[model samples]
Target: MEKLRLYIQIHQLKEQGFKIAAIARKLEISRNTVYKFLGMSFEEATDWVVSLGRRRRKLDRYQDHIVYWLR
Candidate 1:
């Protein structure tokens, strides 16, 4: 949801004539990230963000051990 909001905000700022560099500064994100997001369509961005949440992390195998340690 946060990623979706960022995508919308980036497009909105672009529509308002904000340059990529300016948008990066305003959003406190890297210029490359701004360019990457701008290059993607809204639907593409949504799919990418959703896929990210479903991707496996390297630490997944340690989940049980980590939980036990914390407890």
Candidate 2:
């Protein structure tokens, strides 16, 4: 997720001697996110969860009247 991308960008910056602000601007990620991953290990970064939303939850099952009403 974002954390993994942050880790990669930070490491790439170190090897290229890029400035923090410049890297942050180019990467289009917040400065705080960049800084958080600055010295973090890959495993530490990868543990982040992108979401826990009920994206696959079917609203129709919960609201039978709504489905019939809409149809």
Candidate 3:
């Protein structure tokens, strides 16, 4: 996954003594994002990235109306 790749790249760059600001510039990502990825473990990053794809339920706004109608 692209997120995993980025995470790995951040780690590699950090290991090579790149500063956080430099990493952000090199990757064209925000410094906050760089810090976030750096602080996270690999599995944590994967879970966080995978969870980004989850969408809100389409009918969530109508749930109260639907329940009333059913009742």
Evaluate all candidate structures by whole-model CA lDDT and list the values in order. 0.94, 0.71, 0.94
lDDT of 1 at 11: 90
**Clashes by residue pair, model 1:** none
Give the per-residue lDDT digits (tens) of candidate 3, residues 1-71.
89899999999999999999999999999999999998999989988878877757889899999999999
Candidate 1 stretches with Cα past 4 Å from truth are none
Model 3 spans > 4 angstroms off: 57-71
TM-score, structure 1 vs. true: 0.93
Best by TM-score: 1
- Candidate 2 error regions (>4 Å): 49-71
Worst window of 10 by summed lDDT in candidate 3 = 49-58
Residue 48 error, candidate 3, Å: 0.9
**Candidate 1 C-alpha lDDT tens digits along 1-71:** 99989989999999999999999999999999899999999889989999999999999999999999999
Better of 1 and 2 by TM-score: 1
Worst 10 residues of 2 by lDDT: 47-56
Q: In candidate 3, how many Å is residue 69 off? A: 27
Residues 15-70, model 2: lDDT tens digits: 79987788888888778877778867776666543332324566647687887788
Candidate 2, residue 3: lDDT: 53
TM-score per candidate: 0.93, 0.57, 0.73
Ranking by lDDT: 1, 3, 2
